[model samples]
Structures are given as structure tokens and as C-alpha cells.
Target: MVKYLIRRILVSIPTLIAISIVIFTILALAPGDPMGEFALNSGITAEVRENIRRSLGLDQPTHIRYIKWVTAFISGDMGYSFTSRLEVSSLIFQRLPVTLWIVGFAYLLGALLAVPLGVISALKRNSAFDMVLTTLVFFGFSLPTFFTSLLLIIIFSVQLKWLPFIYNDTLQLTDFNSFIELIKQSIMPIFVLGLWQTAVLMRFVRSEILENIHKDYVRTAYAKGLPNYIVIIRHVLRNALIPVVTLLALDIPSIFTGALVTEKVFRIPGIGALLIDSINSRDTPVVMSITFIYGILIVIFNLIADILYGLLDPRVSSTK
Candidate 1:
């Protein structure tokens, strides 16, 4: 296992480098000046603009700029955002917690609800409860996240006045009251994101469980006088979880991607919103850094999934 892990890490280094190069090249070729915001300022002369460009090293060749950016990034400096004039790394770190809180909690809540609902649906098969759940799952799955977010805001925030329309980033989670406030603000966004994930996962869980339940091993377990619960939970669920684990592991990257839409709708100040703002402002450094970080996360999570596969099913060998 250790050897396999080492090999994967070593392989990922070059893979990450290639990914960074492609991302950098694409961003560099994109049509926008990082200093375009200053172009309309009549107070800033052409010479002053040139000087600013020189100071930022933007006057250098594209390859040279790329090399400098890569070197700075390797040394723990993520460069500065042109618009905000803040260190890119610092900006990301500040907003990362909010994104994590929403995405992480939503995914966990979705999984908790999805697994049980899926199990019950499969156990009951074509019952009325199963039909109702299926209808709701399909409805949630088919709707766009932004639409759901807006609908939720309208219903809960505008009409019902039960929850806040927008998330309050200022709400600190130190004490109980602050924590409760955080939950209140988070409820809408979390529900929107969690509902979609639950719908998707519940279908998978139901299908996998149903398939496993019909397998010979489950039948043999039942034939050996094992209780139905024991047969399903021990013999069936353990095996059924293998594919679900893979799905969940890969979905980690989607936490950021999905948050992009959700954050925009809810007005949450998170990495997703920052990415959108940076892109619109043509802040290349911030965009590149965020994109690279996302790529790294995806790669890391894929490795984790492979490791988990070995753990979940001993028949699956990591060494291979």
C-alpha cells in the first residue's frame, strides 16, 4: 500500500505540472489585460501605465511571466489579486472556510438522509412511500441549483420569513448564539445543495442495494438463518457501498464547482464567488491560482478514492 501510494504521489507531481502549464497557457491567451482597469483613467499616463506593468513583471515575455509565477507559487506566494490588491493565497484562505462549511455540511447531511431513504425505498420496492420519494428525488435532481436557490429564498426568506435570504459571513461561530445564527443563514444554501446531492445519491444507493440484495451471497446469508437486517446490512450494504464510495470521493471536487453557482445566488463571499469576480475583472493570477488549486484537489481526491477502494474491498488490490 505504501509503495503504491508513493508511486501515485510521484506520478501526480508531473501530472500537476502539466495541468498547470495548460491552465496557464489558456489563461495567458485569453483576451484581457490584467491592467485594463487603469486604461480608462485619464490621470494615469501611458508612461505610468508602462511603469506599473514593468513593476508587476507583466511587461516580460509570456514564458518568463509564467516561470516567475510558477516559482513564486512553489515558494508559497500565490501572487496578488490585481483588483483587490490582496495576496491571492490570503484571499483564498479567508473565504475557504465558508465554502467548506456549506459544501461539507451539505454533503454529509445529504448522505445521511440519502442512505436511509434509499434503503427503505429499496426494501419497500414499489410501495407508495417509494413512489413519493422517487418523485421528489427526480424533481430535485432535474432542477438547476440556481433555480432551487432562488425558489428557496422566495419561499423561506420572502414569504415565510423563516430564514435569511443571504448568508451572513459576519456571523462568527464561537459561541452558541453565534452558531445558531450561522445555522439560520446557512440553512437555505445548505438545503438547496444538499437536496440535489441527496436526490442523485439516493438513486445510486437504491440501485446498488437492490442489485446486491438479489445476489447469491445475500441469499446464502439468508439461507444460513441470518436475520433479514443482518443479511442486508452486513452481507449486502458492505459490498453495495463500494461504488457509492467512489461517487462520494469524486464528488469532493464538485463541492467547489457547485458552490460557484450556489454562492452567486446566495451572495456568499466564498472562493466560488471570488473566482467569478476575478474572472470578470480579468485577474489572471487569482484565476490561475484558484484553477490550479482545484485541479490539485481533484487529483488528490482521486488518489484517495483509489486507496479507499482497496480498503473497502480486499479483493481489490492497491498494489496492482
Candidate 2:
């Protein structure tokens, strides 16, 4: 297992490098000059703006600028955002935890709720329970995250007054003070994210369970006079969960994608919101830094998924 994990980690280095290069190149080629925007905003004279550009190394050729950016990145200096005038690294670090909390809670809650619901749906296939769950899953899957968030806010916050309408700050880490606050404010976003995750998980889990019930091992277990619940939980659910586990590993990292909508809607100070703001403000350094970070995260998650696959099914290691 250690050897396989090490091999996978080693292989991810080149993949991450490729991803970084592609991302950097695309951003570099994108239209809009960071210096031009700054100059325009400051109402600086052309001569002063030209001098500012020169001092900032913006006058350099694209290749030279990219080289400088990459070198700074390697040295743990992501440069400064043109708009915010703050270090890109600091900004990202500041906002990262909010997104993490939102995504993490959503993933955990969705998995916990979906798995049992899916199992029950499969167990009661063709019954009212199954029909209700199926309809719910369809509704959850069909609703977009923003719309779901709005509906939840209206019903739960505005009409019912059960929870707050939006998440403006990250939860505090001490004594769960911030956690409670986050849970209250983040309910709508979490619910939206959770609903989609639950819908997808339910469908997959039901499918996997249905497929595994026909397996020879499951038949053997049933033939041995095991209780139906025990046969299902121990003999069937264990083997059936491999695919769900794989999806879970992949889903963890993907939670950040498109989370800007939720963050903006909720007024949360998350990395997703920051990224969107940086792009709109033409902060090249921030955009590049966030892209690089996101790329690294994706590569790391992919490797993690591969390792989890091996762990969940030892046969995968031998095959690899």
C-alpha cells in the first residue's frame, strides 16, 4: 500500500506541473492588462503610468513575465494583486477556510443523509417509500444551487424564521462558537449543495446496491440463513459502497467549483468569492495565484481518489 501510494504521489508531480503550465499560459494570453486597469482607475498621467508599468515589470515580454511569475511562485511569493494591492497568497489563505467549512459540511451531511435514504429506497423498491425518495432525488437534482438556496431562504428564514438567511463570516474555531454561527448562517448554502450531492449519491447507491444483490456472494450469504438486515448491511452494503466511496473522494475537491454563486448570494467571504472578485477587477496576480492553487488542489484530490480506490479494493493495487 505504501509503495502504491508513493508511486501515485510521484506520478502526480508531472500532472500538476502540466496543469500549472496550461493554466498560467491561458491566463497570460487572456485579454486585459493589469497595469492598464490600475492606471485607468488611478487617473494617472500616461508618463507616470508608463513608469509604474516599468517598475512593476509589466513592460517585459509575456515569456519574461511568465518566467518571473513562475519563479516567484516557486519561491512562495505569489506577488501582489493589482486591485487589492495585497499579497495574493495572504488573500487566498484568509478566505480559504470559509469555503472549506461550507464544502466540508455539505459533503458530510449529504453523504450521511443520502446513503441511508438510498439504501431504504432500494430496499423498498417499487413501494411508496421508493417512489417518494425517487421524486425527491429528481427534484433535488433538477434544482440549481442558487435557486435551491433562494427557496430554502424563503421557506426557512423569511417565512419560518428558523435560521439566518445568509453566511457573511466563517465560523469561529474556538469552542465551536464560529461553528454554530456558520451552521446557522450557512444552512441555505449547505442545503443547496447537500441536496445536489444527495440526489447524485442516492442514485448511485441505489444502482450499486441493486447490482450487488444479484452477486453470487450475496446469494450465498442469503442461503446461509442470515437475517435479511444483516445480509443487506454486512454482506451487501459493504461491497456495494465501493463506488460511493470513489464518488466521495472525487466529490470532496469538486465542492469548491461553482461555489461562487453560493458565496456571493450568502455574502460569505470565501475563496470562491475572492476569485470571482479578482477576475472582475482584473487582478492578474490574484487570478494566477488562485488558478495555481485550484490546479494543485485538483491534482492532489485526483491522487487521493486513486489512493482511496486502492484502499477500498485491494485488487486495484495489484491491477495497477
**Top lDDT: which candidate number?**
1
Q: Which of the numbered candidates is closest to the native, going by highest TM-score?
A: 1
Model 1 quality (TM-score): 0.93
Instruction: Indicate the worst ten consecutive residues by lDDT in candidate 1.
Output: 311-320
> Candidate 1 at 101: error in angstroms?
1.8
- What C-alpha lDDT does candidate 1 achieve relative to the native structure? 0.88
For each candidate, the alpha-carbon lDDT, in order, equals: 0.88, 0.81
Cα RMSD of all models vs. native, in order, equals 2.0, 2.9
